[model samples]
Target: MKVLIVDDNQKALVIAKARLGKEELDVLCASSGKDCLEMVRKTTPDLILLDLDMPDMSGFEVCKILKSDNDLSMIPIIFLTATDDTTNRINGLDLGAVDYVTKPFDPFELRARVRAALRTKQLQDQLAELNRNLEDRVEQRTVEINQLLNQKDAFINQLSHDLRTPLTPLVALLPMVLKKIEDTEIKKILDLAIKNVGYMKNLTEKTLQLAQLNSSRLQLKMEKVDLKDEIIDTLDSLSSIFSEHGVKIVNNINSPIQVEIDKVLIKELVHNLISNSVKYMKDEGGITIDGFQNSKDVRISITDTGIGMTHDQLNHIFEEFYKADNARHDRSSSGLGLSICKRIIEKHGGSIYAESQGVNEGTTVHFTIPL
Candidate 1:
């Protein structure tokens, strides 16, 4: 590789060339900064060995010019100096020299520094090239993956439509048959199967909704929604479960706060929170739904006096497929509810967080959506 040695000191330049020459480097010498610039313009070298003190312009000036010029910026420059002062060393380094060698320098150390700089430059070049290639490959793969995903989504939509068309008749017939059945045990079994089938349909619908939300195909119909009403509706939907568990619902939503949000998505968000509360609450425990409007955000909190979470559980509650240790024991949940809630809140320029003192100490899930 080509190397330009720039220094007014002929002895220093000769010694540097002699030491670096043993490695068979193509060394060119310049006695001043002006000559160094001319030499660089004439032939761009891979590296430059520069002297801090020069009769004409100093090495620092040359380094500054070289660094500022787009054409010369990539070439590494190493400074050779006699001064041991901290300021001069910092100034030299800040001017973009890769390494500073103090004089009268050890020849071996100088050679080692040069070799190390060259190796670093080579590695950097390789890394940059690899990154460019990797990026191109990644972009191409992303396009291909997206194409495949679109095809898969189309297939799923078609399959769901076709399956539901046939299932509609069976779903309608099941209830009629159950109504006429004389055996109570058989009728009960059929009813449970029908209920489970309904649950399956709900899961499929939720899955489709999640996919649409992920693909940015789900357009939210935003409107000024009364948060209090939304919370009440969600609570009403979970009334049966709450009653079954002997849990009391407390509404502290004072002074109805209106926030611009998609009613459907907000309903889902509230439903998930309330459902979770109901699922985890101890027998006869109470759940409170509260809302208030701050200056630029409306904050809603669902506080459940239930089998609360640990600090670690609270930290990961919103992660997809992340159920608390206690919740995992049931294994009945898909664990997508809180994750979906997080996505919905974030899509509306909001944030959600879970807080707990500790296990069995109750937990509060708070979310804020901008008004």
Candidate 2:
């Protein structure tokens, strides 16, 4: 470490220098306050021993000037003064001096004070270096995560495109060919082929949608909308499907219940929940939709008069590709519907859960979004 000692008394400067040099420090001397400022700027010593009394400028004035400069402020200053007044000590400390030393001081005490200040400075420098390294590591990890998400999206897009290219023509041409066929066995075989082809196309579209939702790149288009109206519109779009399954939907949500949300995603969420409930319901069963608002959020629920789940089944229902034993053989289910619904609720900054009393009872799906 380097130490700079400033004093108008040449004898005192020489005595202080010899005492500190015994500690194996590189020592420099300045005869006046002006010389001290110039030497500090040039050498940037780690510690400064300043004499308060001087003919040209007081040590307090030199200390103030150094503290004002951002580059020189942190060099620890210790006022070496002959005057032992309490006010003088307070003023020196207030001007950013680290410690105060009396003239004709003990050489042992002076060396000890110098060591303590330098040790503190060393620890501070190490901490600052560690913080910089931590910031760099966080930035690098963010870049790697972004790269992986982009690669996943690219792979999903290509796969969907390949699957759809063949299924599209098969879906359009198979029905036309069936209309011209006369043999009953061949006709039944063609019908089964058409159904399988349609299922594959549906699976491809849903898989791509789920992958996009899972990515960080998806951005929601937020708007203020009526919750009841949105549900009614979704029900209207799927009215024919519900009728074929002998199910009834009773929407009990009131009008003027406004919320800020992404309209398209919410519609998809309601559609999936209702369709899943219908698939598990008894013949001519009913689905009741209801919602209400509290201080912080709006809670909406869809209750189905369908076969309820066991505790073990409820735990894994929202997970991707998870299906109950009964639904495992159902060809219409892709096992991704409820998973997509869960993602949609998460994207809206909300919570979703399912409640079932017991087997053969009923099930209710509840979700909450910010008001």
Candidate 3:
């Protein structure tokens, strides 16, 4: 350890150096606070023995300056004073002095105090090093995780595109094959094959859309959109399913509500929520779509008289490929529909949640988008 002893009295400085000198330590002497500050900048000692009274600067001022500096603040300081009064000692310690050695000092006690201060400073340096390494590791891991996610998205896009090419020719030929066959059982089997192909196509499309939405950078084509018109258009598109299920949709939003949004994405969000409720609904059940606005946001809700979900099912409803037993039995659902809806809403700086009254009662889906 290298210790710098600072005092205006050269004799006192020499005495302090002699007392703390040992085979393992080197002692540096300074006649004034200014000399001490300069030597500290040139060679940063492990610890300092500072005298409170000096011609140019007081020890209190020197301690404050050292403690405020980024590089020198970690070096422990031991104040050497003539009188050990409570106020002087407190004032010195308050300015970051680690220990005090009074004049007419015991040589053995001074050496002990210097040893303890160096040990404390060593621990502090170790802790600072550990913190720096931890921060670097966390930053590196974050970059690695982001890179892996990008690769996964690229793979999903390629897989989805490749999967559709072969299906197109097979889909066009299936109908012709059915017409060429006269046996009723053979025709039914061909129809089933066509249905399964359609299901696969839908699953692929949904997967591609989900991957795009979850990418790190998502851009929206923003414009002033009439939400009522969007909802009406979506309902018309799904009119066939509504009729087949004996489902009626009631739109309570009468006004032409204009909102800033990406029209295509909002339409998809509405379609997914409405279709999801339709799938679980009872015969002759009804669906209601409503909207309201506050100062900072707009809220939209879709409520249905459907076979509602249990607590556990609702908890995992928005998770990708998470489905209740009924949904698992359903051929129409890819289990990605609700997941897509949630991602779209969140991308618009919005939130979505589901509410249900146990099983077989009803369910309501609510979403909010920032204004």
Taking the tens digit of each residue's C-alpha lDDT, what string does model 1 give over 20-107?
9898889999999999999998999888999998977998999999999998898899898888878888988888888888888898
Report the poorest 10 consecutive residues by lDDT, candidate 3: 15-24
Q: Put the candidates in lDDT order, highest first.
A: 2, 3, 1
For candidate 3, lDDT tens digit of each residue in 1-371?
A: 78899998888878887777673788998888888999999999999999997767999989999999999998899998888788889998888898898887898888888888988988988999999999999999989998998888778778876988888987788888988999999899999998888788888888888988988767999999888899999999999999999999999988877789988999989998998889788889999999998888888999999998899998999999887886685667788988999999998899999999989888999998888
**Could you tell which candidate, 1 or 2, scores higher by TM-score?**
2
Q: Clash number for every model?
A: 0, 0, 0
**Best by the TM-score measure:** 2
- In angstroms, how far off is 163's CA in candidate 1? 3.2
75 Cα displacement, candidate 1 (Å): 2.4
Encode model 2's per-residue lDDT on 225-280: one tens digit a residue: 99888999999998998899888888888666789999999999999999888889
> What would the TM-scores of all predictions be?
0.61, 0.86, 0.81
The pairs that clash in candidate 1 are: none
Give stretches of model 3 more than 4 Å off.
Answer: 64-68, 83-94, 106-109, 172-186, 217-246, 253-263, 292-299, 327-329, 346-351
Ranking by TM-score: 2, 3, 1
The lowest-lDDT stretch of 10 consecutive residues in candidate 2 is 120-129
